[model samples]
Target: MTATPAIEGWFTTGDQPALIGERCTTCATSYFPPTAAAAGFCRNPRCEGTEFEQVELSRRGTVWSYTDTRYQPPPPYSAPEPFAPFGLAAVELPEGIVVLGQVAAGYGPDDLRVGMHVELVVEPEHTGEALIWRWKPLAEGSAA
Candidate 1:
C-alpha cells in the first residue's frame, strides 16, 4: 500500500528520518510540526525578532519516560477492532527538546527504561495508515 504522511511537512521518510521544526533566529527556540515562522515573532517572551529558520530535529534520543495505552481514543481516532494495548514514549533529544511518539512494533512500556537510547522510525498510523514517527529502542552496543 502506498503511504503518505497524515500531516504533510511534519517529517520526511527515506534512509534517514528527521522531524521538521522551526527555530527562532533570535532566541534559538524551536517549534515542532513547523509553524508559520514568518507570520509571527519568536515564542520567547524576551525576544521580539520575527525571523525563523527551518531545522531538522535530532533522530536519536534517550527515553525520558513511557507508558501503555490500554484504551482506545475518542473520535478522529479510530482504533482497530479488538484493539490491543500499545506503547508511547517521551524521548529527550540532544537538541534539548523532548518529543512524544508511539513506540515501534514489538515494543511496550516494559521494554523501555529511562535513559535508554532510542531512534526515530516511520511507521503506519493506526487509524489512517499514514506514515508517522515512532520510537524504537537502539540495540545494545549500537551507536545512534
Candidate 2:
C-alpha cells in the first residue's frame, strides 16, 4: 500500500519561508498547524479566546531543544531500510511559540546551539509519498 499524504495547505510563503500558525483574534495567542478543533482556545485563562485567524510566523527562531532518533519510527513514518538516524528539534519562534520539526539533512547535533537562529524549510519526501518540514541555518548576515 502507498503511504498517506500528510496534511496539505500548510505552507509558508515560497519566497520567504516562515512557519504559519493561527492567532486567536480574541486573545492574540497563536498556534502552529492551525488548530482545527474548538479546543483551539488560548492557554491564557483571562482571555478564554476563540476565533483564530491565519498568521505567518517569524522566519527565524532560536533552538530551544533537540534530540536525534536512533531507531526507525513505526509505520506512519516511512524510512528506507537500514534507517539512518535523524535529528528532531524544538525551535523557539519569535512569537514565543516552540515548533517541533526535523533538522535539515547534512547538519548534525554538533552544528546546533540553544540559541542559534534557524529558518524553516520544506523538503521533498525521500520515500516519495509525503512532504516533510525541516529547519536550516539562516544565511549568514541575512535577517530571518
Q: Please name the candidate that would achieve the greatest lDDT relative to the true structure.
A: 1
Q: Give every collision pair in model 1.
A: none
The models' CA-based lDDT, in order, is: 0.86, 0.74
Worst 10 residues of 1 by lDDT: 30-39
TM-score of 2: 0.83
lDDT of 2 by residue, 67-111 (tens): 888889999777877788878879998777899988887876667
- In candidate 2, stretches whose alpha carbon ends up further than 4 angstroms from where it belongs are 1-5, 36-40, 139-144
